[model samples]
Target: MMMRIIYPILGMVMAFTSVLHAQSARITALPLQKELKLPASFETAVEKIQYDLLENENGESRIEVVDENCLHIQFIFSTDKAVKQDDWQVSVTPAFSPSFHWAPHLTPTDRHIIDQHVFRSPALIMADGRQVITLIPDLDIMKKGTPVRWYLDLDAEGNRLVLGMSNSRVDDHVLFVREPGAEYPAGEVEIGFYLMVNRDEPSLKNPFRRPLEFLWKRWGHGLYQDGNPVDADLERYVEHTYNWAFNSWAENVWQEFELNGNKVGAPVFIVNYTQSPNYPGEVNEREFRSVWNQAWFSSLRSAGGLYRYAKRTGNTDLMEKALLTKELALSFPQVEGFFYGLIGTEMHEVEIDGKKYNRSKGWDTHYWGNSNRNPYTWNAAESPFHILDMSWTALLMLRWYDELEKDERLLRYAEQYAGSLLGIQSESGFFPGWLDLHTLQPMAHLNESPETSMSATFLLKLYELTGKQEYKEVGLKAIDAIIRDVIPSGRWEDFETYWSCSRYGSDYLVGKKVARNDMYKQNNFSMFWTAEALLESYRLTGDRRYLEWGQRTLDEMLMTQASWQPPYMYVNVLGGFGVLNADGEWNDSRQSLFSELILQYGKLLDSDEYNERGWAALKASFVMMYSPLNPVTKAQWEKVYPFFGKEDYGFMMENYGHGGRTNAEGEGMGEFTIYDWGNGAAAEAYNRILDKFGKIK
Candidate 1:
């Protein structure tokens, strides 16, 4: 690279960014070409070069070569900077890009690949295998965590590419793109990102495996004596997330809510179970449960989190919370016949489409999963019916009845819930994501994500409890259906990187081979469950193919883990989100589950290969902790007080690596978030691992 310099604090230069085998150098860029156009309010005098445009003219766009070595391009969108809403798009190509093979949506059947604008992280993958990844790190899907998103697409062709981001203007979430046909008034919006082009050996493939392994060895997190690969461990992280989230869970337990002018005390619940501290100038409070019905999994997620943690650790206090959470889940309204679920809360009045709808006034909005962010007008017909919630809720109840205290108060509900799941199974083993809330029948559109695998694992567990042959049959059928979609070779290979399961299969319902819109793409939830199904199938059915499939998928996942060592270990790859976004963003939702599954399979299969890789992956969860290295700034800090904890000592962050630069709102950079999703999963994974293996030293 250029002349090496020591970090002001570290006191020494550590050849941190050097590429051993690759001939890449990020030298101090040469003097900019005189013809290069810059942003309106741009300023940079020190080592780094920066440009800014508070407001922009219509049709105004600029691209400049900032670094000749990496062929880095500066992408800018000209618009009014005062507009606080996110509505802008930016895309720039490296010097040698040709066409794009945008990844295929992860549908189980009739998967279609395309050459269109992609999400979260945008990158230019050269035909020769070189990849130039564009990063808008601050615009992560999670408002608090680093953001990574998929654009609906402004341009489908390779001539242009646009990335997606939420709160681009309001919170300085940079990578920005608007919904298809959704227009913004001519206004101010500042969105920018960095493009890194290098032959750093795209990590997941067979030939590209060296770089990821190399990164961990050289750059892995080490606050201890030596920065060994082992130091990027999962044991400590499990404790961090589990303990913190448990406290929050306990604190938010509302004993009652005012319903019909009466204080009800039956269903104990958490208010801030899935919210981040609101940023400054943001009026949204994170603790309102408005459209939670769309993402019913939130309740099950919290309960399951507490339950798993309590089960793993035998914590009496947590056990009480777990039981209470589940008891509240039992109180959730369910539709007859097929057994649909609800948000376990009331819906207040909301206005939409000139009509008032059931909703509650709150700040809850959608980021990921098919949930109505707008509680006022959230229509069930327009949203996804999350079956995974039903599955987990049943599992929670069953465990309460069978494994834990054997409480029959919840057992009747558990039996009915599990029975409903069985009744809804398609004779052909198909389960659509969008289903009729009442009949448990396929809704208008039959989904393609084929959540057969996800449901299969839950059913298998029920079969063990009741020894029901029908449950076993349904579970086996689901697994078989999932195995049918396994693309044997090529890019998808052993793992479902490009195509597998999804959170929504509504695209298939519309006869669209690709997703037109979404809750989340390339979901980690689907990936983890699929792998778990494979392993569980092996254990229950003694199918060696299932075992091999699980091993192969985990092996590929280990290779694809995108992580950074040292000063940047927080973004290190943790087999967390296998979204396989070429731009290298880490979405840690359910990541710990994937890691935990890998660990379980490793131990049972007696495969040290899986065991070692799994721990490294799980330990990487701890590596996700927030530190002083994040981009969240002082002005943003003023926006969130009681919410933001010790700046240096923080919780797990997900969907990161996209925020290499952009800051919070008008501030310099945004801070990392403390997501309950990451925390809950971390706690559960931690407890289970500790219960079985004891604490790692």
Candidate 2:
């Protein structure tokens, strides 16, 4: 094919251009420094920040500071400044909390300008080996004026990179201070700069089969503090999840409710680990997103996961609970075309530029389309249209129903849902994000959506279940739509094909302190049946493009795969910053099927590297789901959220460490955020992988 030929030629050209540019580029590493001062009115209670006392420290080093938050401040004193101000042109390491080495869209844009004193989040730049490193200032500290001021000297030498910070040579270094307050803690800050030297510059898009040991060694951190030997034990993971499930059963995460007066057991997973009626704040009201106070489509995921485990280990205690998931699909309210949700329609208003567009929208996330009238402030930004979750749930129902053939009613439900999905198929393979349930008019669809279509697999299932060529036809058409977007175009490259609802990928989000998506463009969520959909299509259709696109996504994901090391669990492969944020830093998920997709990739590619990596990912997911000490210590987790058959897991301040977005409101992420659905999916994947491919020793 022309693609096979043209791809290499393009790569070679880019490489040659990069080499030429590198050769001609003069590296003038300017010395950078800034005095960062915290204001007096700083909040007392904060996230993971630590301060420690030095042992028998001298007068200057022993500045007594008392603060509630942990300020594990590491210091590199002024006396021991490595790169002096005079010879600072060689390189400059920055002083700040070392996070993921994100792309330094390191340009300075002055927002908080006090008169002529513009507050610049001077992105501290350093040259480490061949890679140019940008030390991003954490969001908490970018606003304090001249103290946050940083300027550099690079204009004299062709102005390659640092002109954004300074037009003229001001200071080759930066000074930092955590200004004085009762809570701010009076202290002489001994600024320290940590350099994340490049050990291996693996191309972000290629090289799929590298060992995780290297990834752990270079990127992973802190899994052995308690001296617990690291073990990627699938059995152990399953056991821990089993305990979690049984505990939740006792807490009544699974409840009996009346739907259509049939007395259906809710058998659902609550969206938040801390979902309580008493709690009503931005973190609470807004955070409890998924069908609060009841169960919905997503609730099926955990049950599906549980079913997978039961089949794997021959445990049938939870079989009833798992089977109860049939209610999810069965109870869905049939609407104009297909099954919309379990509830009726509600009005959704989006006010853009002061114009309100209010329409009766079909339910997607909240329970059965019923808001449950849970008290909270609502906004247009809280868009309620998730095609992927519904698609996955529908597909899951069909798969389970067909595989078992136990419940004929559920089969009817699945068939109805499938036909409904057919009704909404867009000409361009576009699944409208929001739909006016009454009119059934396309209100809007998210371009490069975070939701992946189940059309291909669902169609195959429909064809198998009913022998319908039309279903297959629609499925192929949907696949075409996806392949069109996934394959690199003249406007976008293959790299951007790790595409989401937004056209602008993570590459554009580098250096931005606040992760926001006001532009509302193309974005992506990895765990959304994205790669799996294509690979599954490839399996059925034998379409090389499906595999190629799937492989392309897998390889590009290799690029975003964390630089985090061990004991530092909690990677949000599920696409973080919540429902609206298609892509953003720090991800957490309850989509249990992510690992299964990885397992499928390994088998399809026949690549040991993928198998190994997939296993590692599953293991890490297990740890994130079960390990109490990952981001929160056992004591901390147990104190607030006692794990009594209740799993304590969430994003855990593991923001960019797991996932990020170009434009996200915030990490609607928190601690002890475990969902049984994801647990089930994880368990299912773990079992399948274990049975298919034993531990890679």
Candidate 3:
């Protein structure tokens, strides 16, 4: 390897030349065009560089690059014997608007600098949107065999981008490049990266998809078990799930009365649940009682489950319950007049057994709770209105109106929710992750996040149902924002739980200094949700470009999933997904949602290839469910956890703690809470699957 490094630099001083033909162009020796800023210490250190074609039409193919657009470069560092230390980084300018992971071009903010990482897939899409240039480091050379911790860098201004190989690490979503006494190494170090320019038009294939496909085929496919004794018995898993729903989870509606000091003219559906005593932690007593005001938790998720089950079995009584569940969901505390559609993003205490309790009050004390933005105010103006809450609720209403009933009231509610979104849409056509309920102004630096596709999804759904021109126009614009901004650099952040950043909600309103904790970088749920939205865009418009973008995003999202089981103790984890950055960590709460969306992509595209992968993902979703029938996994759970000795059909573990800081270094089998995001969401996914595919044999 050392001898191989010497040959590339033999002609390092050759003059750069561009060879052009009628149809093709090539650069024989690449020149540094941008005024890249590097540390003086690194500049002073003795070094040499080697530039060559990494690959052309045919060569040693480590990565695919167009013969004309590929360039290989290597940097050799000797030593800095002076013992002086300084933070090291190199920066280059991006020539594109709506740049991602680079400083956000349209909405420049401090937040953009926080999400820098090795996996960001740093790239710059040209303004014409027809071509993209990607900078990919040779990971094996940079990190596997070396002490280098390579990370990307982006300044708050749109002018600078960096690929930092030294004195950098993104800790707790903050970029920390300054290390005390950090100096150049003593030995020869070689750093290498590839630059490939590819056509980004709809007709051309995405260049980034190749590596992800290689990973999935080489590692991801082999890890999954065909007949795992977990939830792979989809027939039984679906049956027992619905059985738990109708029997233990469902609530009936009675006459209007003063229950728990609030007038309930309509039926109330309870979706909240307690932290299982079997799990580690001091269980909250209040969590045993259902709480109101949460969009995903209180009713919407479970309503979908019941509605689908009713439709499957033609159970009129269950159908009425589903309708009532949706009604209770819509009746949550909402903003009036100008923000008429904004719903409460905080949980309100509910009376259970004649005592009021806030289920989510003490949740922040748990390890998983750090992801939630808790202790938020109830004030409409100060509290941040989570877009997903309104998006999901509006989508449910529209779906119900279209499929179940033509009730004009449902249409009115959908219009109000989506119309409010239009009022707050950024000039870029994306909605902020959070907005002040009163002023409709963006909170924190959330206006530029790419995951606002959650809102675009609902708008497109409404457009499909009503053929509303305004809805179609705004929805397509948001889709355009996604393609122009999100696809170039995969900065999929700001898709945290609804209550995230609530702890600093007041600080954001008062213009006080607050830590940049709102950005949830590389969250899988956000990516999956965005993929579904892109598919919806493609479905409504018959645009293959949307399909192309959606496929690329899903390939990126797959990196979050466990391609292989860790050699950890306890439960099966082959098919689970890790939350942001913990690539090997297994099992997240959004498995079912991922399964559902991927399955939809397969169905819509009529691609048997994706359908096969989708089924595998669906099977993966149930691996976390503790089933009495699957005694193999149950015993395994008991061996490490001892908590799963008590089986609960409706309860699915959110994160298995197999790998990641999501738990105590992946010590236990699961996290503490068994809330709606897990159980209710899984139920909703399974219900959707059952309705569409029929008994999942």
Candidate 4:
């Protein structure tokens, strides 16, 4: 019996051997290709020879040949990915008869191919046996703004495959291929590549488009009249606003009033308009402008000064202003050292040509009137709660001082100020938000709350810049107190929680409270300030908890929306209805209905809804008060109106016309006559938003 032995051809051998010569050839110009055998199973049958110029699957033009045993190929097109002469690989395969079934084997694994500055590997293989190869190059040395490239080789039977090439510069590239066979070169191939580049440029357009110019254009020109350019009037308004805040205001109250005896005027005490009854009680008809206490004015002036300075110089020109404000604030009457809060003291009465008018009532007895009454004093060992005003003022001073290049005089003052406050911190990390100015006794009634958190935030700043352990310790204590007490008690539960201590009846004193409007009353400024404090504290201590708490608080505040009324009016909803009727209306408060809403919504929190709401309110308020025109120039405007309409303006004038004026009734009655705190507050809110998100010119 004759037995025929059949030996199964191991396709593994073909794979291992087929690429051996190609690998050797890459390292050296050796004749390794000559030693390799073109497997008989891998056949190239030349029924016909064809010369064709074709673009390779890589988007490159190449010369190709067709024959029985193999199809020879040469590339002509060049790209960044095209392989250099030294990186090329070549393979050959023997022809097989048409009747013989020859299947080239492909093993997909984590193996990689390295070329000149490029590394290639297979990422995936489809169920149909199509190999996806990825190419990557060294990124460190790659030049910017360059294109990338790639190349591939196929055997005549297409049984053997080689990949090589270069392009601009890329991290990786990919190509897909099916199992090689006699018809390999004829099969479809796919190449995939990716690139990323940067395109950045500066522009002159206002990024934030603060309604400043827009409002001016709308009202300054022909918005009300027939035809007018209005640009001139708009420019005047811009200049006036800038000059008032930066130049005139800064130079006059901020800079002119120096601690070195150039005092502009005596420090005055003013009443909380809400707490006091209207002037000329029942019969006397006179317009009046609510005056703020010296400390309050100083704070306002300093803030305005800083804003103006930053705008004009792109630097801290307000350092002097801050220092002056601090000094004058420290010298406030009634309160010995630093003014704890707004004091309602009788300074002078409205007089015409030296005639004495009705004496004004004293309103300087309490801070926030009924809520906090602690005088501004810090007793190292006794004060129950550390007052935050002193610390905040000191912090603002220090920050401005540092920005102003660390003037030794300012630093010395700051150090002294910071040290005095630091002495009052308790071992348990509690500080008072109010204290007796002369006795240095902590006002326990104020309670140790997030108000201290505000102070602690500033203390952290002092520690960071001065490397003072005491400040840091005090700051940490403040932070601890808030974390342990305030946060746990949900002091930040809602807008109302921000001012947990202040409430009228059941509602917090925010805007005019309408029973329907649940918006919490309180200064939204605290919201941004608290966030800033938390973020700054996190940076100083590198504590994860600080960051986490800050982020959480921020998230909560962002989700809460302010309540709104007719004409799309919005007021940052405070606790509940107190002064305003059920409809959210208020007749007693001087605050704008939506001042806090405008301040908190879009600017600090990045809420598009709030931003739109704020814009709408601003527009409505402008139209209601200012007739959308320049009062002085009588020019038609398009953007913003500085003052209200003539009638409204007349009302405002009358409201402020205490000496010899009649009380008028109507929107214009108390309009411009009385400087609406809401308008200033809203302006402040707008300013803050611009400062935070407005584009730098």
Candidate 5:
């Protein structure tokens, strides 16, 4: 019986190989043309690239390259043996030309193969400010049972953009693995891909929306479950979201600290938890914490959410918690002198439960198996003050003052921060990314960062709030500077996250001395930040150019999102954004943020297209929430992360990995570790959405 089955399979494999061999007789590699000034990076023109069809056996492989406006490569694999293949990968690597530089996407310098979660685009995009070359894998070949992973290798040896099929039978959060058996009837297969070279146009929309459309057809719009709406009860979802957040704070997130010799306990938002949902383990006895940091991840941001949710539901306890968060944020030490009025972006020494944490200023140092583990190394206590973080935090505080509380202290703090910014405004109207703690000179990245320029929005808001002409004048000047200096470069990236390594004029990166562009760009958050600032400029002055620029940046941001759904039942990919450039992972933290921006743009411009897109984004925001009300996602969530009990319903994980580990312990598609930025951001966005849209259900 075994022999009969084996013989038939063998016959099928031989027949397939013979057919492929016969069809490949006319396939030939084209000769390189020097007169055309063809790029040396072209693989077909420069190298004799080939593949072996049979395992441990040499077999005929045919390759055909078609040269036109785009380079098209077609291949057919022929094997003599009757071998079967259940797992296989096809990859295309492009050699980079010296004239074309790789775009900075904030992935590690040494990264190669990237999982779908972190895959930036279907194409490996490279640009030299003018021309953009994109190498995209054929979508047909990538639609296998397992999720697709991309291969991007860039170095002196040349660059490669390859696509591969992942192992189908993966455990929870498992990314790359190979089962030692074959399921396919034959090993014979065909693959094809193309590379297009084009001029980088300012009006360029996402040319890679094809994969999104394909997935929408295959999976029926990511927001739908069996043609029924998933996020129907936006009000209930918003309430449940807040409940989960308050519960998380009560259960695991509250940090008890003795500040200035006084016992203080408040809901502190940590970056992430890896060891367990409770307090993460120590890194040099310093606990991993977010502290009073970036406004987007700070407790102030969480407080904003708590305040709105409490107002909507009339929960006084939640409102008190909100006020506590605000107080905790303002309690951080402030700077004096040249950087007077700005709160120093330094970690403070506080005793937690009789043990002193933040002794060396290393929060989020070694939380989720990350490398930068030593507390003494790259300590925030020794780092320069991040002006972007300070200004953004102040902006949020001021907003709270204007909307709810007209606190005298809040107004004073805003005035001080604005005054410091006014004094340091450069002749070019650009603001430095970081300032020295003591000297108050520009410490990191002498060049203007589009991310930092977003502080201009705060100034505009303050100007409106206080009728300060100086704030308005400097704010408009900064906007003009962005249009003059930054827009032309097209490097509108958010580099604020990595202050240690994102310096321009100096070789000081973290503890090591490196070149200017060592850290690379972080994420697509800058595009949205720039867009928001530009849009605010447009709204304030009615400048059409600012509106256009805002639209362009918003379009650029939409490109970073996952347009395609991977062939995974456990994880949802559509509308999800990756953690970093080419880093290979996705998370649901920014979904509501993206939605808010899109909706704001839609309302400002009164465009139906953007409005529709915004609604879809809003739906995608809560798609990952592990709530029993969301039956589809609830069941799907259980499949990937079964550790969640009924109490963990409203919980959301930090990462929705394509194939990366879910947490330190689990090897699966999504993680179990919760983050304030993840769940907190969602809750805040939903609350704001409720106020704006008024019960989306």
Candidate 6:
């Protein structure tokens, strides 16, 4: 009898162990459910048994459940007074779907899913003529292992409210509302139940906790993973180049200047020429000089500050630099509450001192000047394009101000700049690509130019902050105008011609003579701008077409690089250049490769392969430019008479040929470029990438 009993117990233990092993092997699995819902009014007499309720001594309410197939909820409220009819709102969030794995810092065993909406009320006019908003979920159709809860917030006076809900299978939800020193007619509000569910479960932690890890799971991320280490050599080169450009010998110069309080007339000025445009053998010496001087002292100070910030404390330094830059930039007199681009010259100059300079002398006279002879310049004041550039700079300042939290002046200036730009809007709900600086009239002839796209992007950001419908409308209209005029008309070939014409309103400029269109088949910058615009619009509107176009353009750009070698990748300390063909061949003597790599890196947060390729390209170009010794110096020197007298292109280019050796032997000893645009772009790219991929919490 004892042997038989022992045998039965042993069999039972073996069976239990087998069951545990089976469950462990499938730990990531979740129950599949068709749907779940909670009616807007919980008035429906439906029966579901998946809940428990508990009442505390303090009159607080708690709801609990432990089912994989259903969510349970309960409500408790004070019965001291009659409830107000329409003073409360209900909200329910369904479990997030786990289509992808959790990010690095998150636990894979925890719930992870996308939040889905169930119900929202239409604009409801209250009896008192006030608008009340509300939403609900249908609980019966929720997915398996989903968490459901209800929220109640009083729009009017409420002394105290306490509510809590949790599920053994999911995370907890809590709501607390308190209004002190307020009295209202004694009333009680009926608490109702609302349920919501998606095909997946909601995550217990914040979604953005692991951006890079999540990014790696996306289709693009997988491609990047496969290609990354294979391009390790290139990555090393890029990282080395970036280090030299932003953190090496050049950085030492900046640090020395900073140590001296950025005093004027330092030896650093010798390296300043690199910040200006370099055009070889050009007869127009004056033009070249003008371009070089355009890198004003103030701009250099700001750029240097930014570089320091990037290399040091990312946030603290950035905040300080942003404030300083804004203060300095705004100190310049405004033509019409806008800073001028250049000094002394009416052409390309927005303003000088307090006087309104002649707009006719600029690139487009009528847009920015008082002259009617050149309608192109007439919209200078309302040039959304120019305004957009300022806005971008201001936005950067604003972001830093938000980080610092102590400087009110920086925040105030940023808002002032943004508001001034917004004031230029026309009656037709359109922001002209160009504006008449004198009259503030829309330069309608410029068409829905690239400014339309860029402005839309900025407006969207503004809308998020301000919650103003006008901003949203303006942003949507700009996007719509572009889609209607530019894309549908097949004017992709006319990449440079401004499409907003007075007669045609905003239409495609199919046959306009713009050098951007004539020289290159596609303006690479425009494509990037448009891509960002479309993606941002899609984020706001959930319009698939915007996403589709963005993805298509992005894919095209990425795939094109597979075939061709980038030309003169060492030009312009910054990454990127103008005009890339479908095959990835680029033109333009001056290439901003640093900007290109950084820009592409920003986009790579969403794509794995693109990110990998971007890193590879960035590494290759960076190493080639900043390596200690110029490997090609001897090769190029052999071509010159008396090889000992050969020019060191790398050293000369990096140091602006100032205080640098010109012979191959002195290659690694040259001074680094100081206060150059390349440094700024590199700093910006590094910070941006670090923000996206760094492990900091």
Instruction: Using TM-score, give the best candidate's number.
Output: 5
TM-score of each: 0.56, 0.56, 0.62, 0.42, 0.70, 0.44
- Which lDDT values do the candidates have, in the order given? 0.41, 0.38, 0.49, 0.32, 0.52, 0.32
lDDT of 2 by residue, 1-697 (tens): 0000000011111222110011111221111001122322221111112112121112121111112211211221122222112111112222222222222111122221111011111222223233333222222222222121222221112212221111121110111111111111123323221212222344222222232223333223232222222354556656665665455333424454456555444333333443322223212212233322121225565565567667756877776666655564476676643554333224456565666644334223234452221111133223243444445556766766765446677567666666767777677774654454446555533434424355566666667677788877777777677667543320121112222222333445322232211112222343234566677677778878777777765543433333233122223231111212223333333223444565677787686545544544565454344354333323333444443222432212222222321112222234434344345446666665565566534
Off by over 4 Å in 6: 1-323, 342-385, 402-411, 423-430, 489-521, 556-606, 620-626, 629-677, 695-697
Q: Which of candidates 2 and 6 reaches a greater lDDT?
A: 2
Residue-by-residue lDDT tens digits, candidate 3, 313-340? 8889767766665555555544531222
**Candidate 4, run of 10 with poorest lDDT:** 195-204
Model 5: lDDT of residue 66: 32
The top-ranked prediction according to lDDT is 5
Report each candidate's C-alpha RMSD, comma-separated, in the order given.
13.5, 15.1, 10.7, 25.8, 9.3, 24.5
Query: Model 2 clash tally?
Result: 62
| Candidate 2 stretches greater than 4 Å from native | 1-232, 266-268, 271-297, 311-316, 342-367, 370-386, 447-452, 486-523, 526-528, 566-587, 590-592, 625-669, 672-674, 677-681, 687-697
Q: After superposition, how far is residue 679 of candidate 5 from its true place, in Å?
A: 1.6
Q: lDDT by residue for model 1 over 429-463, one digit each (tens)?
A: 75655454435466543344434566777778777
* lDDT-superior candidate, 1 or 4: 1
lDDT of 1 at 450: 38
* Candidate 6 lDDT over residue span 1-697, tens digit each: 0000000011111222111011121221121111122332221212221211111101222233212212223333334443222112222211221211110010111121111110111010001111111112222222121222222221111111112122111121110122122221333212323222212211112111122122223222343345421223332333343344333433222222121243221112123222222312211112211111121122423343353454455556444444444444444345555544322213333344554422214212212211121234433233233444454445444444444344565455555655666687654434554454556555545344544566677667667666778767877777776666554322333123222111111133223422211211233344455566777788888888776656544432332221112112212111122232211112111122322433443463465444454554343233223233334432432233122221222222221111111223432222333233333333344444444444111
TM-score of 1: 0.56
Q: Name the lDDT value of residue 347 in candidate 4.
A: 31
Residue 117, candidate 4: alpha-carbon lDDT: 20
TM-score between candidate 2 and the true structure: 0.56
Candidate 5: where are CA atoms >4 Å away? Answer: 1-117, 126-135, 146-232, 247-251, 255-265, 271-293, 337-383, 445-447, 483-522, 605-609, 630-643, 658-675
For model 1, the run of ten residues with the poorest summed lDDT: 3-12
